[model samples]
Target: MIARSQRERLLEAAVRVVAEKGYGAATVADLTREAGISRTTFYAMFDDKEACFLAAYDNVAEALMRRVAKAYEGEERWPDRARAGLAALLGALAEEPAIARLALVDVGAAGPAAQRRYRAALQRLTPLFEEGRDFAPGGRSLPANTSRMAIGAVAGLIADELAEGRAEYLPGLLSDLLFATLVPYIGPAAATREVGGNE
Candidate 1:
């Protein structure tokens, strides 16, 4: 097989295998079999199963970030941008339950390395939510961890939905997730109004 194709298939298989079996149970053999690649090729691409899973996790996280960032681009206001970004995120997760599971749920079981990677992946979205600080009324005075807290809230909400086997219903959570994201940056009254304003 072509090198690039095998690599892509391996990464895709990592997502599928890990999502189906969970990180602890998924083995290198399973990844290779799922990818239709040999052990040698798999080793050539990655050091081991964890390495492969990490690569796959990063791949999905980066793509999801790109989608949310793209959605936020044209909206004029922070609330609108937040709505657009959260909608994009929820819609994407809903479209791929395996990805939803793998990204938010499976990685936690993968081990310390994977957990660190997951945390780092969540951190990458900081800039997206950080923009809300400048948009808020007491922008500069909000808690130092405003962006991180909002990110955690958003991630936690999505993780709960995914853990409950409600991936397909994720898109419908747009309002709730938006409120969680905006409430800290804005406030309850304005956040509630913004949540209802667009619907």
Candidate 2:
């Protein structure tokens, strides 16, 4: 097999180090040790540990977002799109629990810049949720802020699940998240019906 690039090795090592030691306790030395690279190489590749971590966050978040987008594609109905997207995201999280914790949990604890990246990552999903407004039953549109909150709510729930080492169970949350996403626009009865079909 071809060897991974130095940058790729460093990012993967960063995720592992953060997952094992946590962002607050992890250091450049630890990351370099995990990557089997010298400190000099680490500096050559990244400005610092935080910089490397932020890059890792972007990498994981973008990859997961792409999966969700792909899963949602070709599904005209909103609920179908949502179920597909949610399942894609949860599957990714379950398959890469370390990366999931690094992106969803440790990134926020890395520092202010990481916090910003986490917010940006979460905001990236807002457009996906915002689209739900258009398909809301009766041509109803949810408040713009509510759509944003729904995105944040899903992130927060996922973060909590990851923090508790429940990443493998995220796929089970599809219906609950779908219900939450639909509730703001469609009333309870309709949202329940939407989530129940699971088509």
Candidate 3:
């Protein structure tokens, strides 16, 4: 338990250090000092700065996933639940600007670990798209793979907007953009019904 706590503390410190200094400038000493742990403890916990960074990335992803899971709870319709989840996530990102930057931008520069983390998160998120099974109004069903791609695209757009400091308008824009883009693929009848339901 103590070991886990120390690892978490180190990951938190690593996030702060990376957010403040960028991945290129962040150092193990900086994270150790920020975590209030000795260098020996830091080294014992992580193989190196890169290893620490990967852990930090996982921590951020886990935090974001928790927010998503909470946002999705008790929502019946897939589309409605998706939009709410997106809004909650964007709101969380807006509130935690540093963490947002770290997750969306700094991690990208950290190497393969960043890409792996992104893929893992996307994989975890794919199941949410299955909720589209509720769209029986149009007699057209969305393929799970396509839904996953759509979700990934929407997430990518949100990350781009957040990185550019345009997150304030992202919720509405994402809703409209995703609706427009995905409705076509889902077919006219399904699209019409879904859009009508939103109004």
* TM-score of candidate 1 against the unseen true structure: 0.95
lDDT string, candidate 3, 1-199, tens digits:
9888888888998988898899988899999999989999988878899988988888888888888778877487666776666667777777777878677755678888687786787567666665555554442455546666666666677677777877566655645544643463565566556656766
lDDT of each: 0.89, 0.81, 0.73
* Model 2 lDDT per residue over 1-199, tens place: 2234877888888878888888888999999888888888888778987888889878778888999999987587877887778888889899988888878887767778998988888787776777777787653444548777778778888889988999888888888878877777677898898888755
Stretches > 4 Å off in candidate 1: none
TM-score of every model versus the real structure: 0.95, 0.89, 0.84
Order the numbered candidates by lDDT, best leading. Answer: 1, 2, 3
Q: Which segments of model 3 are wrong by more than 4 Å?
A: 134-144, 177-199
Q: Which candidate gets the maximum TM-score versus the true structure?
A: 1
Clashes of each: 0, 0, 0
RMSD of candidate 2 to the truth, in angstroms, is 2.5
User: In candidate 2, how many clashes are counted?
Assistant: 0
> Would you give me the overall lDDT of model 1?
0.89
